[model samples]
Target: MTTDAETAVFEEHRPVLMGVAYRMLGRVADAEDVVQEAWLRWSAADRAGVREPPAYLVRITTRLAIDRLRQVKARGEAYVGPWLPEPYATDFGDTVPDTEERAVLADSVSLAVLVVLESLSPLERAVFVLREAFGYPYAEIATMLDRGEPAVRQLAGRARRHVDERRPRYDVDPAQRRDLTERFLAAAAEGDLAGLMDLLAPDVRLVGDSGGKAQAPLRILESADNVGRFLVAVGGKSVPDMSFRFLELNGGPAVLVLSGGMPDSVFQVDVSAGRISSVYVLRNPDKLRSLASA
Candidate 1:
């Protein structure tokens, strides 16, 4: 039996645990599963000597996430078309008062960064999520992972280098991104190819994740002309009772397309040098399930 006080402690730390798990697994369902498992462990653990409940809970969550990640990697399941991380609904709200810290958290969970994180090893990903996103001290992270402090440092270094080299560097201004997203949405809705082209970089790439369950590009489409044309085509089609809503997803503005009041798709763009560098379209119904109520 879990005491109410113990339950309150678990609830207080749930957000951080969810953050760590989601970043590690790239799927909300998997992350929630890991968090639930962590809850079970936390409820049953012997806490007489546990001085830090937050750290203890985090350790259990991180370890569970790592094991789940390893299992997922070992399966090597072949996904249909390009796979993007499930769109995570984020609302930093008043919890993150510091602009700088808020930006860091948002950037870490961005679709662009999560895509890059998918390539890192399980341990490296764990280290990166804990150190970079949450700002955990190296010593603390080592204790959590049951690894030497020096080894944790090395993992963090390698993960940082790998992410820095591979992740797309996008402009981080929220206002700019939101403005462009609105403009982009307008252009697409009006079937304005030139308007769309004007906002896209010459080498802009569009990665659509439909899992072959919906209509999206089977392969990544590159070049402003190709991407612009595709958007125009998609925009021209009539979706019965279709509507759009702008929400902050993964720390930035995104367009959520709804058909008949149900989530149809999600669109987000990465901007660089004042032009749209990458456009992400997530149409997989499975991935959009959680966003239906948002």
Candidate 2:
């Protein structure tokens, strides 16, 4: 029974709601479900006196995401092999024009930061996402979480500290990252062990997430020697009707490997001090499903 005008209003803020939900849950399906639930609530609610639609929608999405995160934790499902956030395709296009704002959004959604966020409590993560990623004021966040301003501020501070201590520092220049990624890909595809080692930092670490459904390292592979050898070995083998496409994933360049036009895996790297520092390989088919159409 929702009017067209009201539906239009909800659609206008859908992107922001999706951003908040995805940042909170780190899973596309969960985030989408939370957003859909928010739509259901908005459609059925009394909207006559609602003054700020964006804030209201965001609040519903955030709360739902927090509840979903808590339920997921309670389930205690075991994830096989090392886990990484599902690669999120980020094409800001014309939506984010300000360089500083774009950088903030990208950093918040980066794989490294998301991995660090997984260690934070759901409440802390919610506060951090709202205050850091979206720049919501302490009072506004307090109202959203039904928490006092001081309590919200404390949560933000604690979450910020934890993230600062654990998050790996990577070069933010996209050009540098893109160049390094291209060279790394070339070296890896060519099975050039020396070239791969040269582009990798001495202490480079590679984390592969296969969810036990694909062939990937069960344990994290570390050091240039180990990582280089693994890549070389992997490259030496032939994938049937394999193809590669470059896309912007998680706010950075990623190589999507497809076998027979279906997503096989995604490879993204973090650059530090002009060298590849961390390599993230996502082979989880469930996680790659979204990228299949990209």
Candidate 3:
């Protein structure tokens, strides 16, 4: 028999576990699976025998996430094109009861951080997430991973350095990001290559993922000129009646929908100092299935 207090504790910590799993695995579906497994372990525990419920649950969630990450890595190695993180339309106000905590969680869940996390190994990723993102102490992390303290420290250090090297400092204001996204969409919809060029950074790159199920740019295009040319071609080919709707994606603004009401693509805009740094286009039909289901 489960006590009311245990149930309350489970509800209290569910979001945190979800956040950790989401960051570690980069997929909402996988994260949900990890959390569900955590719940099973928690429910099966002998309440009188175990103590520190929150930590116990987190340990279970982290291990499960690490396992999932390994599986995802194998899939990515065989994947046809770029693999992007899953996007979620989070209503923070409704999901988080506390205003201050909600703000912190929202920042941690941003797309830039999640995308850069792709570079870390499964164990390194778990250690970094627990230490940096969740503020777990080295000793606690060691216990969770069943490793020595020195090993945990090494993993976290390597993970941190990798992230620092790959991801630029992201400090764009939300209002500015929204404005830039709107401008880009307007240019794209109108097939205004000149207008679009003005928004892209000099070294901007575009990566498209179609998973061989839909038409997409098979390879990554570097430099602003190539990206501009490709966008112009796509716009010219698209039907005149196509519409683009801006939605919250990976905690940033992104576009969805195309001509004849078909799901088109999901884009991640990297902004540096007010200009678009890069654009990641995810067109994989399997990846887009969630959007279709929604």
Q: Rate the local accuracy (lDDT) of all candidates.
A: 0.96, 0.94, 0.79
Give residue 83's lDDT in candidate 2 (0 to 100).
87
- Return the candidate ranking by lDDT, descending: 1, 2, 3
Model 3 Cα lDDT, one tens digit per residue, 109-136: 6666777888789899899889877789
Candidate 1, number of clashes: 0
Candidate 1, after superposition: displacement of residue 99 in Å?
A: 0.6
**Sequence-dependent TM-score of model 1:** 0.99
Off by over 4 Å in 1: none
Count of steric clashes across candidates, in order = 0, 0, 0
Off by over 4 Å in 2: none
Stretches of candidate 3 off by over 4 Å are 1-5, 74-77, 94-112, 239-242, 258-262
Q: Cα deviation in Å at residue 265, candidate 2? A: 0.3
- For model 2 the TM-score comes to 0.99
Best-fitting candidate, measured by lDDT?
Answer: 1
lDDT of 3: 0.79
User: For model 3, what is the error of residue 94's alpha carbon versus the real structure, in angstroms, after optimal superposition?
Assistant: 7.5
